[model samples]
Target: MSRPMEKTEILHPSLQEVHQSVDTTRPGSLWKKIFAFFGPAYLVSVGYMDPGNWATDLAGGSQYGYTLLWVLLMSNLMAVLLQTLSARLGIVRGRDLAQANREMYPSALNFILYLLAEVAIAACDLAEVLGMAIGLQLLFQIPLLTGVLITALDTLLILFLQRWKIRRLELFIISLISIIGISLFIELWMARPHPIEIASGFIPHLPDEAALYIAVGIIGATVMPHNLYLHSALVQTRKIHRDEAGIRRALKLNFLDSFIALNLAFLVNAALLVLAAAVFFHSGHTEVAEIQDAYHLLEPLLGNHLAPILFGIALIASGQSSTITGTMAGQIVMEGYLQLRINPMLRRFITRMLAIIPAVILISIAGEHAVGQLLILSQVILSMQLSFAIIPLIYFVSDRQTMGKFALSTPIKMLAWLVAIVLIYLNVRMVVEQISGYIIQSDSIIGKISAIAGGAGFMILLLITWLYPIRRKSLVQKGYHLHKPQTPTPVMPIHPYHKIALALDFSEKDHAILAHAFAQGNPNTEYLLIHVVESVSARILGKQSFDQESQQDQQQLAAYVRMFEEKNLKAKGVLAYHRRGKEIARIVNEEQADLLIMGGHGHRGMKDLIYGETVNYVRHHVHIPVLIV
Candidate 1:
């Protein structure tokens, strides 16, 4: 077959607007280039220390008094390993976890995995919403109901932030992470725990089943499923050369990136558990599972008002930073699995609403105190979905046919399997314990049926994914993977363009665009010159628009057609009045053009926000080849 379109380009790309958008190939000092790979992991790091993590950390520390610090260390190590593998997949295969799954797994299985992924994102988003709302309440004395409602506005923040560069978004997340780290440091400084006890806590001792549960929680909260999907896609933001040497360099640098960012996340989490151990567990008040209670207890117990204020600030930062990343992860999985794209603002709104509606109902019916349990429940829900993401990721990166020279070696693959087994066991154990508790103690038959049915379905899914066979030999022959055995690209039949679409504006640059279109075909080609009238009247009135600007646009188009006729070329002029990008896409489809030629406005940064990036919009919506001059 003629070389099929690159898998990423087959349908669409992951985070297409920012895909390979950041430049890492520029000549620079090694450290400068290393720093370019740093931001994606930092964004992934926030998920490790999100609000979901706080509940577990605080609970682990306050109840066990730093005894589970080893668990925190263990979980962070797992996070680093899995995240590195994720980045490896993206860097080498140019496919996120979701997209890779789409190609490798059957469609029915893929759909189920997609639903599981969405549920995971929604659960994570719930924690963020609750965390931010609670932080606002603790710091500003805003009522919890009002604070929860206020959290909805962060979707608007997402809309505003999506307009800027990916690096800008990363910088914003890093700033928030710094705030959280500093706040934790200040809290730790004020509550001085015994150094020996803190050191002894890393001995891997678990006092009881309660300690085990908390340990598993720390792991679940740390090794998030959504972050795996996010990291795989986010690493693609940096443009890296695809040669072996460059691939090795990128793998090395991304490991460093994961090490630094995840360890920072570990520090933030360790501080949370340790802070609770010192201020609450050691002080004999061990019931500080609730964040608000922890905030209240901090000021009195630590004898400083700034402690609570800083705590609240850190909480807000954590929620805000994580909510942003969560939204991006939602986008990745949706686009990667479903193979469709939606407005960022709309996705944000939908994800946020899924969280908010439940939070509001719980608070209204049971009171704000119930939110603490809800946070824990969300993490438990996430735990159920974690294995599905992790198991497939390990399998993908482990396949020699799938990953080629970058495939995980036997030793590393075994180790990755080890980590997978550990996490899967811990998550399953915790899920069983939680579900069993409800089954035995609760009276609701609906809850019982839901628990049993969901567990059975999850187990069935686990078996299906794990046992799903891969036809490695067939895959290699088909050249479906980046690393399969090489064959010469088949020189297939060539088809010249009979009709070409040229997207233009009545600017001096139009000449350059027209030149490129002519280069594609001679006078035999039927040229369709298309321009979108974007005036106020045109935007509101469509074809009926009779404003002066629209009339002038018509005249300009007619003149272009006349010029083409004078040049002994067949040409037709099409004028559309509406959303420029969609209108152009519609006319291109209607005209059955095989090739599309347009000019890049070279709009970057804030200029893109005002003038809009119609090029990206149109490219995604159209099926034709786009040649941007």
Candidate 2:
């Protein structure tokens, strides 16, 4: 007898394989369990310590001399709390933040949220690309534009690593993070910052307007909008039991993972600030606002030749590590909100290109100063989008209908709201201050008009985002339904078919296709099950035939046929050894299928553009009506 499929078995197709690769059933020590849940938080932690954070932290430390350290600490605390909520949303509800938003909100609202999220991602990527280029310039004496082009090639590296193992990718990121930590620790030792002053820096203080501007930048850089979405999706990587105890265990382990990783990130950020304060500020280089400026000063100020080299190395590591995670976050966001999946390679290229073009253009026109200003502007843009993500996250996690028993406790809920309110206020104030400053400084009448119009337009958008109804009135009014379990229903085809052809990939999505196909099946219909085994590798290796591969595919197809036969349905299986896309098209033609039904991963953006989807190829190749389940 076949085991019944659990709801938890359904996952985003791209992540399904890596989801829960750890052994949940094995009786293991606490350390083993901790190890299993360790990867996601570290991936997210990279964003916190990325090159974007560096610009803000360096600026804060050099200009304010550790007075803004409290902002970093506060931001890290906010990250810890929000990330815990994000992980719980994924583990308990089986939905990433984007998916949850899609399910909960109307299309119009979701579209607005999607656009804001994209802007945040682009801003992040801009900082990363700019930082990497600067690092390359500092280290190899390469031209900035040339280095920007070189950074785009990292997309190929990202694609290669993704095809490897998820664990390998995680370890690679962790290793880079370790390099960053060690590099900064050595710098901290060399700088010899006062322990008492460092401790006092932890106490919150805003000395003036300039301090406030840097503090907001620090907050924006620290609690990233994309990381919230990325963490929610990444936690779903670990496959855990969907039962009560399983969720509780996963949540505990996930929170611990977030806590440890975020603290490490906090330390790295603090170290950057402390090093800047001790070495740069004390030496009267308080105006060192740019990474390039910092690099040029590090060697002379510290009197060690290695100081500048280490800084360059750490900057490159930060940019590259952050780039990889930013790409993944882009994939997750597109798939979850838009139900669109694309080739990971193309997705990386598209996002990287978007960031590269403007950066290169600005750098070429304005030169080096533009890079620092752009990096800071990117963080500010991220801060503006931060509330859009946070508000939805808090809303979904607090709803009893959404989180069930895992709904936030009363005090926690209050705390989350307080955080949300504070972030919203900070973002608004930052925008107001920027426009007001522009108005005061502008000598032209046109400049004042532009500032007034931009400020007004931005405020209107924020008002709409806040007032837009995300939940249905009845759902909101009904409040928490602690006892009821909400199960999403699958939409099935309404029209009956005389003949149907189904494509199988033997992936986790195979069962979902089967369920949808069976839902549309009847006694009168003839069902054809087709599985194709590609011999590209065999051909590459100079082998004529893949007998073992063909045999395995045949067996799997037969099992599927048997499963259908036991249900008393007229079904037959076909195993073909050929290329995936071409062979599937041929079968659809030869079998004379009236309606072709198959599973689709629904890739979007550059992935869809660069590497065309098989479903798309098949649709164009054949004349039969097709339905992608």
Candidate 3:
């Protein structure tokens, strides 16, 4: 079995920090069970109602009145269905959309998809940066540019939140969601919109060419591509049982979570549009398109200062909440597509910078009024990228081999494709309309050439993505690379381990654990000893802890390393912080250990309730064989 240890290098999971990080196995009531699975969707839900959304809904309501309310409704329905499919993909396949796309699509196609996803994220961050800056301007009267600078500091906040439990972060987002919902409710109540008109707004109708532009923005803002990618990875944070029955149960509960969470987002969005319709459109302030304009007019129209104050508070909350999830989605996409790993702080900082630089440039040149148009343009870019992500998702979930019995039924497959086609059609039509209008108005040869070239390039890329999967099947059938079929490689016999890791607790049994670890290793073999400091100081301060217990643990580990060196065998000692079993797994992977040997306390039954079973966790998290002595 040791012979195969070198072959057992498991690929690191998507969102490695939080993959199966939540414990839903706690014996509890039905309600308690429901709460356990409630987090991921709440996290994804915030993205659906982020600052980008506020811009579109505000523009729609102020300009088109409640006519675009149906757009929001339609977009919400689309969002709910697509998000449910994303969750189902994650729970059933254990692969996020990016991961699935990489595995299923060709390499060149994967790179393009990755780029498109990044563009979507950057566009989203643009809206978020502007939204938050606008919020600060409205609330505390900060200069817009200064507030934009201030938004960059949230990278630090993301790094801070990441150090805590996943559920804690989810709760933080939920609190923000509540603030936004309450603020919207108050705005709706104070405006006292005619109930009949609000109802009529739900009936679908686009009033003009301008209305069509805002309608696309609303749809783009609502059913985001990044959110779809984000949702799949977030659902994997839950510890779902892997059997058919267990997976089905997880799917059912997560669907409930998505339904409730997304509907709340819908209400926030609907209220934004409604508030604008009632307060601005009817009041003859129809050009109140920008958030700042709406903020200023809120007090005069609603007859209260509190209306704008609540608006600002909600806007800040939305921007802050959306950015956190946006960074996480960035991580998922980068790791899933390119297999690149970087520090979480660095990743967040880089992503924020991408968004910040664009906003800074645009604001410096055109001043503040142009921010609203930029926000809407960002959503349209996101809308254009939707099919690349969606088509792959449909291909994966519909495949019988990938999803097994849980694969979507034929009718559902058609519906999913229809959604994808509609998104693609809207995106193409909008881009063509913009280009055609631009070419007609501009005499600049370079500008027209650039516009047409860009449009054609994107269309070509989309066509390739749509056809690549089918083309792959056809290539193999045509025996394009036909040589005779190769025979399968035969398995070799097991050999003794060449490299071993010992998980030591510094208890007296550590020596016994060492004896077991050395048994399978030859004189040429190397050894690594791993221990985690779970003391209060070590837990709180991590590697910087200089407390007595940490010092002693460090010294003890050094002593163990010296003892092994005396035997003339290669060896080293490593200190890990926080959780014991988790650290042990990380160390084992880092050291490239062929096997892990750890001593069990044999604390079964009630004793297990006190100290926990770490050995099981280590084995499950690591690919190497674990020998519990």
Candidate 1 local Cα displacement, residue 47, angstroms = 0.4
Best by lDDT: 1
Q: Better model by lDDT, 1 or 3?
A: 1
Error (Å) of candidate 3 at residue 537 is: 28
| lDDT (10s digit) by residue, model 2, range 1-629 | 21222334344432554666655546789788679878899999999999999988899999989788889889899999999999987787666778777766767777878888988999999989988999999999999889988999898678667765677888999999999999999999999999998888889879998898888878877899999898887887787777778878989999999999999999999999999999888999999888889999998889999999999999999999999999889987887777777777888888998899998888889986788778877887888788888887887777776567778899999999898898889887877777798899989999999989977977786666666545354113221111234698999766778778899988888888888777777888888998877666443532245567766777899999898888888898877665667878998899888888888866744465365578878898999778888
| Residue 395, model 3, lDDT | 77
lDDT of 1 by residue, 99-163 (tens): 88877787788898999899999999999999999999998899999999999988768877888
User: Which residue pairs of candidate 1 clash?
Assistant: none
lDDT of 3: 0.84
lDDT minimum window of 10 residues, candidate 2: 474-483
**Superposition error at 564 for model 2 (Å):** 34
**Global lDDT of each candidate:** 0.88, 0.83, 0.84
User: Which regions of candidate 2 are displaced past 4 Å?
Assistant: 1-14, 439-454, 469-629
Candidate achieving higher lDDT, 2 or 3: 3
Error of 2 at 602 (Å): 24
Judged by TM-score relative to the true structure, which candidate is superior, 2 or 3? Answer: 2
lDDT against true structure, model 1: 0.88
